[model samples]
Target: MEKKRSFPKFLSITLIILVVVGAFIGWKAYQTFIGPSVTDKEEFFYVHTNDTYDLVLARLKSQGIVKHPDLFDFAAKKMDYPNSVKAGRYKLIPGMSNRRLIGNLRGGYQEAVKFRFANVRLKESFAALLGNSFEADSTKFNDILNNEAVAEQYGFTTDNFFSMFVPNTYDIYWNTSPDKIVARFHNEYKKFWTDERKQKAQAVNLTPIEVSTLASIVKGEALHVDEMPKIAGLYLNRLRKGMLLQADPTVIFANNDFTIRRVLNRHLTIDNPYNTYRYKGLPPGPIMMPSIASIDAVLNPTDHDYIYMCAEADFSGYHAFAVTVAEHQVNARKFQKALDERNIKK
Candidate 1:
């Protein structure tokens, strides 16, 4: 046939060509999948949009979420995502591809943090909550609470900043600014006091601010929701009769330290406007943040003739209502006896 065909030469040339093509394809595929595919070991990641690329890269490296930050940067740039990046706190998970991550970042998806304000003391507790979300200056927040101009602009008297903040669960972005957080509380408070509430405030011959202050008192005194209306009635009766409300919570609030576990006669003498025992009427302002239930109680008090109340000796989270000071003294004595027996002086 053909002069003893050089079979080895033909075979060698064919093998060389096949090897080159295979290597080229393998390299291309590696480049495409290596950065995007989820590795077997990765679990979760936290991405911060506010961070610089270098900072993000550093965080990713520290968290072991990525092997190379440069890879992410290059991919994001290629996909035109760097310019469209949105700021937020994100949670990254396993099996997320580069394309998906880019989409999440660009769409501004964020994880929400739920903050609850139920049963909170106004000054100290609210400050702590604000600090959790922002690097808030507690002094500044307190100053604003006491600022006459700021209070007036927000339809509150400078003396009653606590009344303007109602307690509720708020869903906030992780990095929300302190001012914005405070503004949201103010807005929620405003929403709760609709036109109907305004009429009720006028009907009671109380300003919205006054109503809130009374609600704060109710919130502090009533241990249970069922007792709210009765407590509200007692205070309203006192207001109508021009008697001292003489609420113990007011004395506690006036102390400001919040550490006075017991409202002794000595504690009542502390010179502060919030001491209803010393002052004849409502304090200069609200003592604590009121719940909507408390607000409603103040707006719609029970029609009872009760003018006094004392915690039951049972400490059952219910109050003993009375129409006379003598009756209240009997209840008080019973409660004090219980406190003595249980060593619960506070």
Candidate 2:
């Protein structure tokens, strides 16, 4: 009887030990799957293209976002997520589970980059801006801008390739290729020229490029939007009367000297076709990337007799318009006097 009792007691103790072990294992699994895995304060993780699971895991550990890297590695392998690593910007919230993080990464969810650019002086600057916003190299982007053969695919030349990009905020994936980036610009440019705008261009007897060329000059001349339409009208009147545009901005553009504050007689002597004083009509392309407002100012120009414009002598960002050269000379003299007083000779 004593031996039998001892055997039963031993059996009961063994059963209790097994139950305790099973309960501990179950609790550990629940913690792995449902309990919080990431500590507070982690917000982002960048997994570069072609990053292996080991590399990403190392990165996660290096970032100090995961407390139990070993547990995560095991969970990832068990879920078959290690082989399907995705490249993108991922959102990491505090107190996230390993299962949730793995699933989020495996699903390939990416955050869009809010990219913007404007008021650039050259294609090189534009390229730099795009390079900083997107993933392309700045030099490669500038090269593509100047490549005529590549530009040919987009119906542009090296000279007019800059016209494709309009100033706006574009929400796009961070990894968008340079060609696709420019393609989106082309698409936006096309959509901007609506039927009404096209008809307006026809009424003005100008192609879209011609309109843009003139608009760029008007934009350069008039620093204020309110003055842009009048300046645009003055240029249009000059074009109609077979007179030279004589735009100072064109001279600066031809010389590739953006530093010219006051265009002089010497600047007017530039032999480049972009020099409107030397050329008969519009230049081969825009001197700068004109805003849509400026383009619309050209398309819907104000009806006026003004054929010339000089910067206001008051130093305000406005212009003085004149119907005759004598009146223009008077306005020019006032502005020239102001320039001399301010010692802004260029």
Candidate 3:
């Protein structure tokens, strides 16, 4: 009977040992795969474009993302995440698991930047804006923009290159290269010029680029959306009648001075191709990035015999349209009187 008791006692001890081992294994598995591993203060962790796995691991520890680096290292290696590190901005949940973090990193799931701009007047400023927004260098972006060969490759001159970027909010990757950014905008430009838009542009006797240029002028001239089509019609009438565009915004652009409240006689006499008062037809390029509303206004201009426009006397952000020079002069005198009354000297 004592021997039987001893056998049962030994079996019980064996069962206890097995249970302890199983519990330990289960705890370890949970710690490695399911337990919270990330504890960063910030909501995002950045992985640069050329960061190695070792570098990323070090960053994880330094950034307080992982308390136990060795466990993270082991997991990374096990998942073969070292070979597939993508550069991007990754979101960090407060209590994420090692498996999930590594999976996201390996899978290249990252947030996109909402790239946006408006009223950008110069290519340099455009490049600067891009540099501030992306990882690419500003100087490199400017270089590519000013490169005649590169512009030629894109079937554009440096003069008309800025027209390719239609201003609006775009979902773009932060790590996108400068060249790729240009290429992407070029693709968007192509997409924007649909067959219907092309046909309308042709009917208006303007190429896509020329339409953009004219649209920029129209945008410059009008602030009210309802007035855009009327202003566009006036400009088109001038173009058809072989009259100079005589756009004040072009004078401001040529002077590189945005503070000009009034375009004086001296401003009109400036010997620059962009001075529409001196040169005929649209400027070699856009004076500013045109809005979609302005572009469409040019595409679907109001049919009218109007050939001249002047800002209204009441500062209502509207224009006075005319079919004859005498009527235009009357509107101009009213605006001049208003400007004089307001002391709007250039």
Candidate 4:
């Protein structure tokens, strides 16, 4: 027996209910489409220079970093990020919002794989590192390393393939080309050698290549960084006195296989031109990749008269320097005893 509601009140209540239901549905839809849908976190996406906007958008959508490809296209057009995006490898994470993901792509937040070449002995290792980044032809790289014509064109001597490379960590894009990378390394090497370094080389009567060759030897022999200058002085003094360099690393370099636990008496008899035990001057090329510290040490050696050196029995990153043959023999005997105790033989 209740009275009927007014028309205005009835209409108001109906509209309010419809509005609430519609708002709820719209919210649910937005929530469902807001973030990435994928669950696998390890998979990554790579973008290249040749990728178009449509292609990038599709890749982002497939990777689950973006909720919709249309949203990326709209944002890319609005924000002008399409032209700004750089090519590289990017890790796509789930639940990443569209705006932030596009920002990452635009700003080029791609992970750079650090390539290090410390203590690398052969040219093949360099080729391998470059190959990983560029998918470069290893055969071509090896040919470049061995090609006398190319070496001469690059101002490198064909005999010393290892000398041309300096040891350092370089940040390289995953898609870097091997030819470009080799050129960059050569450029870095040139930048490190200033006019002052050239003058120092001239003062020591060493050509640029010879200086680097000596530096490579210093790098290999010096167990510690601080011992480089002293080692350089010992070798330089020997060279001045016209004595045999007799460097062990040179023999290893000539042999090409550096697996000898101890350089044997017979090993010294292998007559390659790089064998400093038989040759009077520096080897035709660098034996290993030289560190910058080692290069500087060769340019500015300590003013000592040391003509011979033997590793310290303690292996404390120091060498026992000797000015005469008797002292050298004593130091050598001490080193030999230490080696024997450690089960290392020569």
Candidate 5:
């Protein structure tokens, strides 16, 4: 009788201990799964290329993003997340559970970065500017951008590849591959040149690339956005007459001297195809990345008979347009006198 009573007592004590241990384990698990694991402050965390599991943990701890690094570590290990780390920019919210965090990482569910750029001029400059949106080094981007074979595959050459980029904003992922970015741009270009726009180009008797080249010249000449169409018309008039476009912007582009505020006869004699005074047709490439406004101005050029434009004598940003040689000479003389008064000799 005594042994049986003692055995019952021992069994009760063992059950109590087991319950306590189970409760503790359950609590820990609940904490790991349902408890807040990330601080409510930071918005994002960067998982760099090839960042090891240990490094990510360290980063989390160092950035103070993780409220319980030890618990997260345990959860990550249990989920087998170390070997499949995804490189990207990820958004984080405050009071997030480790379960969600680890699951998101495992799923590679990073959001795309908001990328915006414009007014890119040179190929090298564009490569460097665009490289900031991705993980790869800019030099690799530059090489790819300059590769003639690659550009030609996209209906462009390295010489005219600058025309490929339409100046506008974009949204891109941080780890987006270079080729995909190029493809996206090409798609955007195709979408931009709608059937109606293509018809307009046909009416102007210029190819898309030719229009871009002319638009670049027009963009360089005028400051007022309203004047772009008129400038386009003036250049078109010159083109239709088989006369030289004689664009000062083209001369500046040929000389590769952006500091020349005024074009001189010396700059025109650079013996380069970019100089419209020397070359009867469009330059082989765009002088700079033309703006959408400029491109549209070309396709929808105002129909006019004006063939000459000279800076106004009043130092206004506007230009004095003329339809006759005598009228152009008068405008030119007035502008020259103004320039002499300002002592702005090239």
Candidate 6:
């Protein structure tokens, strides 16, 4: 009887030990899947194209995003995250669980980048801006912008294609292709030129691209928004009378020297198509991306007989306008004296 009692007691003890071990394992699994495994601070994780799962795990550990790498690895493998990794810029919130983080990453939830550009001086700079913002590099964007066939494919010529990008804030994905980026800008361009705007362009005797070209010159000339209309009017009058535009900004653009503060006689003789002095009318294309205010100014220019414009001698961001050559000479002299006094030689 004593031997029988001992055997039953031993079996009961073995059963209790197995139950305790199972309960402990269940608790560990629950904590790994449901408890917070991310760091206290929010972070960003990037998975580049062609990145391996091991690389992603290493980056997560290096970034200090995962508090328990071993536990995270166990959960990730169980959920098959290794086979479903995605490339993008991902936002990692604070105190997130391992299961939730892996789920978001595996599901390809990407955070958008806010893309904004204005006053870009050249296509190269524009390409560089795109490269810095997204996965596509400057070379890719440049190839698309410079390709005549690509430009023509989108109903634009290479010379005028720069005007297609309407400067504004846009929400874009980080991994967007270069072609898609250009397509997006083209769509926005179409939306920007409404029927009313087209009619206004017709009323001004200019096409949309031509207006954009003129608007760029006006934008370069005027530092104040209120002064753009008058400056645009002066140029329009010159264009109508078959006179040389003789815009100083065009000369600077032709020289390819944005640092030239004072336009000299030598800069006017560059013989480039962009030199308004040498050209009889508007330049071949825009010298820079024009702003919305500048574009509207060209569409609604001030009706006036002003034939010439010179920077004000008062050092204010304003211009002095005159209708006759004699009056223009006087204003030009005052501005010349001001430039001479400031020693702005170039």
TM-score of each: 0.82, 0.86, 0.87, 0.77, 0.86, 0.91
Worst 10 residues of 5 by lDDT: 1-10
lDDT of 2 by residue, 265-321 (tens): 899887999998988999877788888888999998999999888889999988888
- Tens-digit per-residue lDDT, 239-261, candidate 6: 99999999998999999999999
Model 1, 196-250: lDDT tens per residue? 9999888877888898889889989888988897898889999989999999889
- Candidate 3 per-residue C-alpha lDDT over 141-215 given as tens digits, one digit per residue, 9 for 90 to 100: 899888888888878889888888899888888888888888988889999999999999999999999999999
**Which residue pairs overlap in candidate 6's backbone?**
none
Predictions in order: lDDT: 0.75, 0.85, 0.89, 0.78, 0.87, 0.91
* Per-residue C-alpha lDDT of model 4 across residues 221-286, encoded as one tens digit per residue: 888888898899888888888889999889988887677757878889989988999998998888
The candidate that wins on lDDT is 6
lDDT of 3 at 263: 90
Clashing pairs in 3: none
Query: Any runs in candidate 2 off by more than 4 Å, and if so which?
Result: 1-44, 63-71, 94-96
Model 2: ten consecutive residues of lowest lDDT: 1-10
- From the highest lDDT down, the ranking of the candidates is 6, 3, 5, 2, 4, 1
How far is each candidate from the true structure, as Cα RMSD in Å? Answer: 3.9, 3.4, 3.0, 4.7, 3.8, 3.0
Could you tell me the lDDT of residue 200 within candidate 5?
A: 91
User: lDDT score, residue 194, model 4?
Assistant: 91
List where candidate 6 sits over 4 angstroms from the true fold.
1-27, 40-42
RMSD, candidate 5, Å: 3.8
Ranking under TM-score, best-scoring first?
6, 3, 5, 2, 1, 4
RMSD of 2: 3.4
